[model samples]
Target: MSVSTETRIKWTSADLELLPENGNNYEIIDGELYMTRAPHWKHQTSIARITNALVSWSNQSKLGQTIINPGIIFSDDNNVIPDLIWISNKKLESCVDEAGHFTSAPELVVEILSQKPNDIKRDKETKLKLYSNRGVREYWIVDWQLKQVEIYRRYEGKLTLMITLLDDDSITSELLPNFSCQIRDFFL
Candidate 1:
């Protein structure tokens, strides 16, 4: 929502550029400025654990490159940052802009869900719809509190539930063969 002190100013991708690097996350949705609070250490721990495994798989298989917190101008009015994105080398070479934003959607985006209510709702609904419509093929929502990951894949241009991975399950992407890890590691 509109929380910026600069009242009545519409937030845009260009406006996001004007923000100082103040260790805060700013996102815009439908012309509203959403100032996201910094996440807790638990969030960082989960991300680090999962990223380590992803890096290992990517390096071993040469599948692609993984980036953290990629700034993307999804639309003229939506300039949100995703937590982690894995882009196939082919897409990376062709779609990465001079400013480092990916004009083309990444193959996969991983969102580490926070305890905050808005964060949960936005990740499950807002981001799911946004990324899916933007052509992100795979979306993974990681919930440390639940110790699970929900995978949504693009099917016929709509997001469909691909899988719900629990702690005991080995998480694998049907889209990315040979890339997988134990689901519980994400919470550790």
Candidate 2:
């Protein structure tokens, strides 16, 4: 009798370079490759609104920087492009690499959930675990379709579910001092 074994390919950041710029988003989580097509218009709008709020606050506070769709490379096999990220000036200096990608975790990471079930799972479960394990201080999962935001804050050395804000409610962050916005703003 002959014994055969199957070998699975563990994707890495190097493999991402081989893919064409085809208007799709690709990420490697735990050595697995996940891809999604371009997001919907509402998704883009939500990002814009969130960016505007974060950027405005960051500019005034001068405490950190807010960026959209930055490639955060925790490792060769654990890289992701989050919807948005806000990193303190101190942490940014330490985590950013010469290639201009974040080599480590940021202060905060945000993900605007897409319509697809897989994408939703990636944000809420897979990426949540990845960010928590890698020491991200805060993580926000925004569901524009539902007009809600789930905020996770670092607690006892891990990201913990702190609160969920509905459309009528406002959102605030301890990581970002004095930063507040209504949940409805994200949908608008």
Candidate 3:
């Protein structure tokens, strides 16, 4: 099977406008449209575990709302579909667009790295940089296979890898007060 090269895909705001109302999982980065199929069972399991934990915490407290696999527009023409996003209600209300574009950056974003070589590299390096440069306060890179999570926080005008948690270590977010999850539980 041949994947479409970036040059072959022409991206525009109008193109994004034509996406189905039901919504499809896609992202446009630098005008290169990337279509993602449903993740594998292992990936979905990990995501469910992590998302459930965040949802529980967010629900009880007013920390933020955890949205899973939502369409997020990063720029006028750059759209990104993050695995998860935590946006304060204030941010969510203010960033609204009828056309599905988010006018503001998310406070926290999570990207679960897939086993595919191309995806792994892009999630770790490229998307990591893009989210940070766009002023996302905290970014979490979840490595399901390794059972590890890398936490990155913006600091001094750059995104720095603050720590990597493994096994039973609890992953806490500086962006969301009192938000946490045990790394081991993320795999369950």
| Per-prediction TM-score | 0.90, 0.96, 0.87
> What are the Cα lDDT values of the candidates?
0.84, 0.93, 0.81
For residue 11, model 3's alpha carbon misses the true position, in angstroms, by: 1.7
Residue 139 displacement (Å), model 2: 0.4
Task: Write candidate 1's Cα lDDT for 23-100 as tens digits.
Answer: 889888677777777897888788888778888888988979878888877676887788898888888888867887
lDDT of 1 at 55: 84
lDDT of 3 at 184: 93
lDDT of candidate 3 over 1-188, digit per residue (tens): 99876546568556866777553466777676766666778887888898898889889887678888777777755788888888998788888689655666788888888878878887888788778778889898998899999988989987889999999799887676787778999995
Sort the predicted structures by lDDT, highest score first.
Answer: 2, 1, 3
Error of 2 at 80 (Å): 0.3
For model 2 the local lDDT of residue 118 reads 89
Instruction: Give residue 5's error in model 3 in angstroms.
Output: 16
**Candidate 2 colliding pairs:** none
TM for candidate 2 is 0.96
**Candidate 2 regions with alpha-carbon error over 4 angstroms:** 1-4
